[model samples]
Target: MADQVKLHGNWLSPFSSRVIWALKLKGIPYEYVEENVADKSALLLHYNPVYKKIPVLVHSGKPICESMIILDYIDETWPENPLLPSDPFERATARFWIKFIEDKSPVLWGVFLADGEDDREKARKATLEVLQTLEERAFGDEKFFGGDEINMVDLAYGMLARWMPVIEEVVGVKLLDPDMFPRLHALAENFRQAAVIRDNLPDHDQMVPLFKIRREQLLQIAGK
Candidate 1:
């Protein structure tokens, strides 16, 4: 029998999109099971028992959780599109940035979920610090973090392309300014325009309402 591959994901989730992009890039065929994150399914809970999150990849019955982990698994399993660099040192460097962004991503989400102006400002500042570091040190003059072509680092940072702008719009905050981080802005534009990314991205119009509702719900919980 053919290898059975399945993905549990939510359409609006950036984490889910990471796995989707990796699978699409590698030209792998899989079944996509959309999860209602507000009321997750028994299968999603079963597959990702620890996190109980979306974007879980089940390859022939074995489950892999976490978006970055799923991406790495897909890359290692497929080996066709080659997400990470072949060189050991280069791959290590890519992994470093992936981990860096993954660690700092909560800051951006905090900004999104901030209930007050003071909290939003603090979270935005923290997020900008992280982005500035990437702008100055990570990509440098290269077109991408991985240089020239999209790779694991690019996929890891894909949220900056599609989701960040929506967050900025919904929250009425401007973070990714062209004058402040020109290269990073350009990278976001370029990343969004990439074939796989462009085709697979969630609709911004549809996401705005969902994100707004989620932010309100989160803010209510925070206020409580």
Candidate 2:
């Protein structure tokens, strides 16, 4: 197939999930190639030599690295289900929030990678700040960050909707409280129940055990 698309990604990765969401939303037919990050394959390394990472989208055999960048590429390639806003100001505003989440991503993930209790607490605090910012400043009265529909910003933040609770359950901390962050909480529910997003989320049961093992491995490596 000359127009064949292939995605090299892992189920455990939020980044990969975002790309998957974008592809499904756009109704693009593609082959999924699962990659184990622990032991990288020659194909994965060749596709993404700079990062040697997952979520690489191969369109017509040309590889595009980075999840966010791949989403943009998908949106551009298939303009039917537009991920970005058509209006210039709205698009700019959307991109602003997209950049915000990208920068603050480490803060949210730190909780999972933190070894000690104190470090985990600190990471939780930072994660709360990021979530609070999203709740307060990001989305106002919109059902989603994209206003009634899932946009690029939502795809960027959508990982938290499905995966955050699992992380909280595994790490034993509740940060995305309903009362504390009403808008974000509602958005999470709405996001999960949305069209493509609903059917394409990761399983909570499977993710919990995998994340636990990963956190333990990370802690041991860091401790050494």
Candidate 3:
């Protein structure tokens, strides 16, 4: 029997979107349950007891926590449109980049939550340095990080395509310049335009106000 699939996620969360895109790419039909991060549901807590976070994937009552791990689970279970490359070495490389981004993501978040000029500038510079490293070392000239098609690496970095632009607008700063990071810029554009990714992306206009409020809350908390 095919296992019933359900996804618990927050609409504004890029991490949730990562799992959504993976499921869509692999043609998996799953019911989506939206969660309120401010007041998380009991079911979400039950599914992810450790972190009690959103983006939990439940298949046949078995719960998978964390966005990337959920994607890997989806890929392993379905295995039709493979997210990671089949070659052992290539898959290892993809996993490396995925972990690399996961580790470095906080720098961009720091920029978003920055409350002062000095802090904002510091975060911006750190974010740019991370991007520069990816542009030169990670991506180089590949149309997609997984070569021509979207893969786990591309999905992992999907936040840059949608959320990053919104963040840049909200924060009143630009770190992804085409002139400086041409390859990365092109990758973002291509990633967004891909059929599954394009269809599933959240509306930018809708997200801006929510992000603005969240940014204020974050700053207020930090100030305290």
Best by lDDT: 3
Residue 196 error, candidate 2, Å: 1.3
lDDT for each residue of candidate 2 in 57-129, tens digit (9 for 90 to 100) = 9988899999999998999989997999899999999999999989988888888888677888899999999
Candidate 1 Cα errors over 4 Å, as ranges: none
Worst 10 residues of 1 by lDDT: 138-147
Candidate 1 backbone collisions, by pair: none
lDDT of 3 at 67: 93
Q: How do all the candidates rank in terms of TM-score, highest first?
A: 3, 2, 1
Model 2 lDDT, full chain set: 0.89
Tens-place lDDT digits, model 3, residues 29-146: 8999999999999999989899999999989989999999998898888999899999999899899999999999898687898878998999999999999989888865677877
Q: Report per-prediction Cα RMSD to one decimal.
A: 1.2, 1.1, 1.2
Q: lDDT value for candidate 3?
A: 0.90
Query: Which of 1 and 3 is ahead in TM-score?
Result: 3
Model 3 TM-score is 0.97
